[model samples]
Target: MRRSAPAPQLAKAGLEVLGEGVADELPSYEQAFKAVVNVEVAPRATVARSAPGASAEADRLWLEHARTAAVIDDEGCFLIRGAGRDWVRVRRTAHTALSAALVPGAGSMVIAMSPDGRRLCALTEEDDDYWIVVHRFEDRP
Candidate 1:
């Protein structure tokens, strides 16, 4: 199997990456559930273009403290749609994984921020697999 390259850093966009690895390496379901539970839930605030499938439980938790973002699109595209106008799409590196783990029946790219607004986690789909990328917001002087 061919390993994909590391994802691009999102620091310039105010998100500092803490750590990211394949979700399959996690040891237990309890840990994965804990990570996904921390993310804040809200009703749809912006218009979405496409609806990607949901994520799997095992792939949801990559880090305990790291914030996760999910992007669901039919074309397996990862996008950051903010304010219902600005659209920032990530270039896919790994296969998009839309397991039935987190957010069942969710569509479009999933972007979630940490409660304190200091961190972010992003999920993207590519080549029939889902990819998870995480970052924290850097403080400016």
Candidate 2:
């Protein structure tokens, strides 16, 4: 399979998981759940305009957001929610496993495997249809 080059510009956009963030330590199931549950989207993202001719091309948008951000404390972890379709995504690297962070489901949750097991991601309902895009997850330092 072919993969896109790692994005260096994402850091400027505040893509924390993709940049500035380091590999975080593994967390217990309980810790992961708490972190995910505690943090919410807080606010929604405004729609972005497409380049002149791409208006009809369709684009992805953030429909809703969890109120709190992913919480990280002295504890191990806090977020691990089951996907709706009996499928929960887990990412594993040669040395560790990473659980799915965000779950965006319209019909059902999509569970995908990371080629390197270093990251796991999900799609939001913004597609109008069930579309998914996942990325690697790096542990926070």
Candidate 3:
């Protein structure tokens, strides 16, 4: 049998968790990331929530991507309906807050989307490192 060393305690605590039923139709981060064909890292660190420039950044992302793609926010993941004229929150098994890693001084989430609106992803800073969580839409929203 091949045995691997146990993960470090701090690493375990810093892990980004995509909790069960982020949305009934949304697959786990692992499964979605596995099927991803492309990735684009943000050019700079994302602004922290409630911090200066944060709202601007959010607006830019929302206008650029959320208009065509599904969105994942503090409330959980959901899709904009009817050509972005309306919205529908995805149903989840439990109410959960979608957050990044829980490390001190960690920057806010940086988001990226596919032009085709088939994928959305977020990068969370973890101390000096970063963790990327991806969500792939099997069909265009």
Instruction: State the lDDT of candidate 2 residue by residue for 53-128, as single tens digits.
Output: 2212212221111112222122222122232211122222232212122232332222222322233333223333
Candidate 1 Cα errors over 4 Å, as ranges: 1-54, 62-107
The runs of at least 3 residues in candidate 2 whose Cα sits more than 4 Å from the true structure, single-residue gaps closed, are: 1-107, 121-124
The lDDT-based order of candidates, best leading, equals 3, 1, 2
lDDT tens digits by residue: candidate 1, 43-111 = 212112133422432233422213223322233233332332223333332543323222323422344
Q: What TM-score, over all chains together, does every model reach?
A: 0.30, 0.23, 0.30
Model 2: lDDT equals 0.26
Write down the lDDT of every candidate, Cα atoms only.
Answer: 0.33, 0.26, 0.37
Report backbone clashes per prediction.
25, 23, 0
Worst 10 residues of 3 by lDDT: 80-89
Greater TM-score among 2 and 3 belongs to: 3
Arrange candidates, best TM-score first: 1, 3, 2
